[model samples]
Target: MSKTCLIVDDSSVIRKVSRHILESLGFEVTDAENGQEGLEKCDENMTDLILLDWNMPVMNGIEFIKALRARSDGSSPKVVFCTTENDVEHIREAMSAGADEYVMKPFDHETLQIKLKLIGFD
Candidate 1:
């Protein structure tokens, strides 16, 4: 079966763009508007990978990741933070919070592919 991916971002544009890129890469993509919705999706069916955003209405990426990692099946999905937070502190924070990889905002298809490759997903 094809691999599954969940994208959690507040921006519709980002979600649309990411969905297209991930679909092109052969990942069955599902998207949520925020962390809470993402968690709901996860509870229904654990995805193989998650592309997360740092900021959102309900919950943020860090909060979602921590909650996800707390679950028994949480460690199964590779979490990648896709956000505008490019500073060293944010990057370190994300890694510490259980993100497998990081991608800056406004990423292109090639950049996403590279990030996924780094996580052995591409």
Candidate 2:
């Protein structure tokens, strides 16, 4: 069966691009505009992967991941922070918050494929 992926980013362009890439890789994709809405989507269905963004309104990626990790099945979904935050500290923070991987913004199909493979999703 195809795996499920959730793209949680505030930008509609990012969500649309991510959805296309993930679907091309054989994943069933969904999206939300912010962290709170992303959590709502998770509550409705079991998501296998989450492409999360760092900065957003109404709950950032770090806060969202922390809250998610507090849930019963929070660890079930592998989270990958897809954002413009490329500093070492940011990467470390994401890892500390239960992110399985980190991908910089404006990722292409091949790049995303490699990252997903590293996380055992590709």
TM-score of each: 0.98, 0.98
| Clash tally, candidates in order | 0, 0
Regions of model 1 farther than 4 Å from truth: none
lDDT of 1 by residue, 12-89 (tens): 999999999999999999999999999999999999999999999989999999999999999999999998988999
Clashes in candidate 2: how many? 0
- Model 1 residue 20 CA deviation (Å) reads 0.3
RMSD of 2: 0.6
Instruction: Assess candidate 1 and give its TM-score to the true structure.
Output: 0.98
Lowest summed lDDT over 10 consecutive residues: which window, candidate 2?
113-122
Model 1: how far residue 102 lies from native, Å: 0.3
Candidate 2 lDDT, tens digit per residue, 77-118? 999999898999999999999999999998999999999999
- Name the best candidate (by lDDT): 1
What overall lDDT, based on C-alpha atoms, would model 1 receive against the true structure? 0.95
